[model samples]
Structure formats: structure tokens, C-alpha cells
Target: MNNSFSPRTGSPQAGSQQVGSQQVGRLYGVGVGPGDPELMTVKAIRTIAACPVVAYFCKRGTKGHARRIASDAITAEHEELPMVYPVTVELPPDHPDYGRQIEAFFDESAERIAVHLAAGRSVAALNEGDPFFYGSFMHLFLRLASRFPTEVIPGVTSMVSSASLLPRPLMLRDDVLSVIPGTLDEESLVRTLRHTDAAVVMKLGQNLPKVRRAIAAAGLADRAWYVERASMAEQRVLPFAEAPDTAPYFSQIVIPGEGKRG
Candidate 1:
């Protein structure tokens, strides 16, 4: 039941004759955008629809969200490779070997994906949001780029999606934009917010209190907006003054006018 992945090894056999004649297989890192299937870009849809095989990252025992987003665009003839990420915090702390075990999983996944690429089959690996924005697809990209012909297709990112759901613009004319991870330490967060025009703090699940203090210290508390599950049916957007005691993992805090100082 433990989910894990290992780097792929060796190349896949050449695909059908017609594809083989093309002489080169392509690896596509396709971004599927946020949770909505309709939000996918035209380029991303076209690349995935044409590829012979489609790959996606998923933990064991769960359906692949990215695949579902692009399901309508894919044909039954394509292949699905679900690279698993088995590392979960639920495992006992004393397991000791968990870290190494997880690393091996990624290695194996990369290797498995490489096989399909070696063949003349173009592989489209689906990603949630933009491929490069905190997505696991980056790991596969790093593994396969040097070994094969790879292309990255950008998609709408969660930050942008979240901002769009809000009534106010994320940034107005001449406003600075600062994107900070909530995981930053108190000092770092405060320093980063001091001179920014507008700010977005991502990954606010457990760091809400710290981030709130930093915003208060920077004197930008009133300008903040808290948004959770943006663009989805369960979305919630509230001003900083009315935000809950804790924010969800998918939540973000935005300060639209803070950029005027810079």
C-alpha cells in the first residue's frame, strides 16, 4: 500500500512504424492548469491530444487529478503512466529509512518514463497548474531533459487563478508584486514585505499566524485578502480582518495595494 516510484531505465522499443519514421520521440511537460478541466490552454490540449502516450504523477490509491482534467482530450489508444509519490508524513517517525526509500521511488519513476521517451512515442506528462510552479513534474523534467527531446507547456497557475476569482485586481498600475512562501521564517517574511507594492503568500496551511504577524509588523495588514480553493466550487475569499484563525493548505493571502510604496 506504500506508494513509491523509481527512475526509469533503458529506452522503450520503437513505436509503430509510422511514428518510428518520425525519427525522434518528444517528452512533453504539459501543464493542465488548476483543478478546472476547462482552464487548460489551447497549446496544452493540442500537445496532449496528439501524443501517443500520457503520463502523470499520482500517489498510490488515489485517482490522478491531472489526468481527469484532460480526460476528454485523450483517446483510449494512449498509455497512462502514473508515477507514484509514496512519501507520506503518516508513516512512523522511527522508520529511519523513509527518506532513502522515497528518493529511490523518484529515480525509478524517471527511468520508467525515459523508456517511453526512448521509443518514437511522444509522451505528455500532465501537471497541475504551471509545470514549474511547485509541481512534481519538475523532477521528471530534470531527469529526462538531457536524455531526450523535451518540451514544457505552461498553464494557468493557482496564484493567477486565485487572483482572478477575487473582485479586486492583484496588481494595478505600477504596483510591485511579491510572491512569498508561508514557510519563510518571521524575519525573512517581514523583510520581504517591507517594501513591496502587492504581495501573495502561498502555502499558508500551518504558517498563518507567522504570516499574519509579519503583515502586521510591515503595517500592511489592512490591505490583505485571504482566499482558499479559488476557482473551485468550494472557494472562499475574505478580507484579512475577517479571516479565520487558521487557513487551509490551499489558501493564499494577497495584499493588492501594498506595492505603492515601491
Candidate 2:
């Protein structure tokens, strides 16, 4: 695989367009929702069903969570394009090499998808959760949206799904909610948590221990609820203090805001 950033240029197409003798196709960034297939929106399902090619990002050895969630809508006739990652958590995200490698990989992926588009084959890029929210599909969208006719279909995010499973409202009355990533430095995490009335800390795999400490230090641990793989079959929900030592990447800690009436 070539690790170079080389983007091909083309005229954007709304529907099928006749670029000379060839017809160009539209691009769809379809959010497949979090975990459960039922959570997928009607528009998302319709888009996936209409497209001739389906694309998804995944780890080298996996079929991709997004593809799995959208499986019921996909048929055998759809051309699958699995954009495998070059590296996943092998190096620190702060490392320069990590950025360079990921950028190159995204560039290559965009080009690959562009090939299908230029050939007049409509491509549906499947994304887990909301495509605009921490979805890998964003990378491809940035590279391809301007050069192709594009539409982004929204879906249920894991954060909202977890909140529903908890059967708890995120914020009420005038309360504020902050969404934080567990990957932040411990001090930064603690600082952010202290100022927020309600919060959801995501990306808690190896950073579980650190995130727990930060939440505790912020005096929010007692209010936090730990949910693993929310909306999935293997789901587990527990109090923050009762949570296990290790957590999956899909796990999160949600601290609901204190309700108040004005």
C-alpha cells in the first residue's frame, strides 16, 4: 500500500453525471449507529441500500464495528471496500510518526474511494455512531466531499445510547454537559472534570485507571456510572467505584447533571 498523500481532482456530481462519456456517482457518508442495527436511522438504511459500493474503516484483522452494525442493510451484491488501518494504538497518539502514518493511510483510503466514484459507482461510506462525531469516516469526507457530491446521514451515538441504557437524563433544567476523552493527561482530565456539572468520558481502554482517578479527584466518581459496550449484547453497567480494573474501548463513564428547576 502506498503511504503518500496524492488526491485526484474531479468535477462534483449531484446525481449520476455524464463526465464526457462516463457517468460520475455521488458519495454518501452513512452513519450506521452505535452497536445495535435497530438504532440506525431510516435515511441511513435507505442510503446504504441505494449505493452500489460500501466502504468502511477497520483494524487490520477486523470486519469493522460499523459494517457489523449495518450488516442487515447490506446485501451480497454490494461491493465492499474495507479500508484497513496501517496502525492502531501501536504508537502514542502524540508521536509525530503516528500522525504522519495515519494521514498517509487516510490519503490512500480517499484515493481508493475516489476510484469508485470516478468510475460512476456510488459509494456508501459506513461509520459507527454519528459520522461527524469521532468517526473515521470524517477523514475520508474531508478528502472527498469537495470533489464529489456528498451527503452525511446521522445515526445514534454511543454516548446517547449509553445514557438511554442508564435510563438517566444527561442534563436537566439549566445544567451543562461536557464530553471529555479519557486520553487527556491526568491533570487536564481532573481539571476539566472539576468544572463540569455533568460529563461523559470516552475512549477508556488502557486509560481506565487514570480516568477513574481523575473522576474521583474531581469529586464526581460517586455520581459516575460505568457502561461497557452500551446497547450491545455484551453490555455491562456498574457504578464507577465498582467498575473492573480494565475496560474496553467501547466503555464510558457518564455523570448525569443534578436536576434543578428555575
Candidate 2: tens digits of C-alpha lDDT, residues 95-202: 989999999999999999999999888899999899898887889989998787677777898998888877569888877788998889999999999887789999
Instruction: Say which candidate scores most in TM-score.
Output: 2
- Model 2 gets an lDDT of 0.86
| Candidate 2 residue spans exceeding 4 A from truth | 1-22, 89-95
How many residue-pair clashes does candidate 2 contain? 0
- Assess each prediction's global lDDT (C-alpha) against the native: 0.79, 0.86
lDDT of 2 at 63: 93
Q: Model 2, residue 37: what's the lDDT?
A: 90
**Per-candidate total of colliding backbone pairs:** 17, 0
CA lDDT of 227 in candidate 2? 91
lDDT, candidate 1, 69-96, per-residue tens: 7888888888888876787655642487
